[model samples]
Target chain A: MGRWQPGARERLEQAALDLFLDQGFTETTVPQITARAGLTTRTFFRHFADKREVLFAGEESVPERVARLMAEAPPSLGPMELIAEGLAPAAAEIFEGRSLDYLLRRRAAIDAEPALRERELRKFSLMSEALEQGFRDRGVDDLTARLAAEIAVTTFRIAVARWLDQHGDPDLPATINQTLAAMRHLTSHGGCSPFLTTHDEDHHRRDTGQLHDG
Target chain B: MGRWQPGARERLEQAALDLFLDQGFTETTVPQITARAGLTTRTFFRHFADKREVLFAGEESVPERVARLMAEAPPSLGPMELIAEGLAPAAAEIFEGRSLDYLLRRRAAIDAEPALRERELRKFSLMSEALEQGFRDRGVDDLTARLAAEIAVTTFRIAVARWLDQHGDPDLPATINQTLAAMRHLTSHGGCSPFLTTHDEDHHRRDTGQLHDG
Candidate 1:
């Protein structure tokens, strides 16, 4: 009825990720992960359904979680406004408590495997669909809802990517905000030179309450 | 290397599509497809590498084709400008001569199968990568190149979906243009009500040469 080991799941995950990094994903086995985790194979099976299954579902129900967060948002906010003010924060918060290094390792694992990559893409696709439905339920028009949802997911993707690149700031929320600004700027101005504008300037402006909350 | 039957490829494709629709993708085989088209299995093998292969590559090398077209585009165009003016037109032209009905059938077969859907997504993913590289080759910065490329794919996806919905007009290039206008307006204006404004209005405006070729 409960996790008897308390942290057995996390330990197994960490050990598997390390093994995936060191010995390769296909080369790693369940018993190997269990031994590395100092847990039994039974415990590993209890934590994960199978080997590839462990490659994902670290944040299982992610799409539903995002949709649930957006559901609590104000109904009056427009598509872009909801995305920037609502979904961005929610998305950033979802990954806030997790270890950035662990995330980077997880990303490497997914990236190295085509099957895992497809599964990741499918999860994001589902998230987009959920967000689209949330916007529609919030009274946004059809096309705008679809556009907003797609852009929301895209913004999350780009923001997380930039954050994980490791050369930039480690603040995930700021990176998310910065990514939203970049999207709005690119779409609005149709220019590329000003893309070099630092997120700090936009961050300061947003701090002064300059959001277009239509 | 020249085909003895000039129409053999098209016949195999169409017959395979029809069979996939009638008897389902798994149920239909190469022999059945050839039989339906009054051709030999040799001809089928000559065309498609396998059964699932027919489910995709109706326009094989699409990403390369797009990147090649964009390679010839002027370097002065901004990211969004290149996408809207250069890439959109090029994408539309690539699908211009094909029959919409055949394309619709192909879409159905792909959508009906998860493997096919993932393959389709992978193709589009490759297309986005190709487009991103094209923008970078033109000297656009990294982030903007990614945004432009991703948005280009998204716009193409939405426009084609609307076009295939078959409720409205069938001129795909115009639909592509309309999608661009919508993206710009959404990003620039941040409002949802005006999304109801028909593409015809923007069509007339573009017809009058109001393009922002930044």
Candidate 2:
């Protein structure tokens, strides 16, 4: 209820989120959401396909939008740079203007429900494919493009989780930048990284790991 | 059943897979699976929680095993090296000795079922956390550990996807190594990466991306 002034769709989203968190996603119905919103069930149906869809509104299209952004990125940028640069705006669009209280509750709602979590993960998989397509369409090599898409999505997801964990202070785009920096820091180091370059070394370390655990 | 020489667990697995593929996951029953395997419901229950659980045997403990391996990795290895070295053994233990046909069919069954796919995704989430713990235990910083863990899981998942897509020919560990290499390649690059280092640039690129799409 904190400064959430909006249109019918936003109102419906808020109402559905409230019902979802209060009574649990499984127990809450469209009728309940509509009643809570002081709108008609027709309004609920107009906004979302079903009760579950209320939580994942716009998720299906998010990947497509992000993919298009990736396609439009300057070829001069590295993949990590492209992803950090491309995904930041979409992250801001979805998360920046929203109330922190509104988002935490929504995240809680999705986390509490298995079905919603599943839907979110499915969307992530779809996002990865769409991101890969974005890179492919821009003439990046297959392996490089695929790796970048997956890594970008992973970085974005981690940044969002961190933003929430930190109570949403530094803005989503900044958090993404922070995560992008850390990700680069982790991968850019190359001291002992011909790891598992041979099967014998792989076996030796694996057996040693097991022996220590045992 | 080709070259699947094993114990009760494997027989139940094969029988359950056969039924799941022959019929949809939702349509299959534990009793039917047991009947197909010529085992009793007692044995079936002894091995699985439900019909759905048959598709994800040993998945719950995989993260723990992986985490232990990470903890046991040489402290001198870089986090990237540690993850590659740690994850390969478990990957081998799960996928190496198994028949390619059996593995492919198993993947197909899980992919065809939403619930199974959900369960699998949940396992990956858990693996990310376990991997994070593995890194944390070894004194990696919070951001680097989290980024590395999430990135490692993503790399493993993509590698597995590639292995399956390539008809499971190369050993799973080989696929994982290749994927790890590609992931490193994606993140290691520093050029143009000061990605979204500034907010004004982020907004500019975002508006441009939108304009092009529009």
Best by lDDT: 1
lDDT of 1 by residue, B1-214 (tens): 2457778878887888888888888888888998888888887887788978875645577877888888887876778777778745676666755687888888898888787777777877888889889888888778888888889988888888888886338577788888877777666456555532454335323533555445
Which clashing pairs does model 2 show?
none
Q: For model 1, what is the C-alpha lDDT against the true structure?
A: 0.76
lDDT of 2 by residue, B1-214 (tens): 3333248788899999998899888888888888888778888887789888887788788777887777677888878778777667777765645787888898999889878888888888888888888888888877888888887888888888788899876967898888886676556442223233454345434633433434
Q: What digit string (tens of lDDT, one per residue) describes model 1 on residues A4-63?
A: 887888888889889988888889999999999888888888768887777564556776
lDDT for A85 (candidate 1): 79
Who wins the TM-score comparison? Answer: 1
lDDT of 1 at A202: 65
Residue A45 alpha-carbon offset, candidate 2, angstroms: 2.3
The number of residue pairs in model 1 that clash at the backbone is: 0
Model 2 / residue B176 / CA error / Å: 2.2
Model 1 alpha-carbon miss at residue B30, Å: 4.0
lDDT of 2 by residue, A30-101 (tens): 888888887887767777899888777777788778766776678766666677677788787656457888
Top DockQ model = 1
Ten contiguous residues with the weakest lDDT in model 1 chain B: B199-208
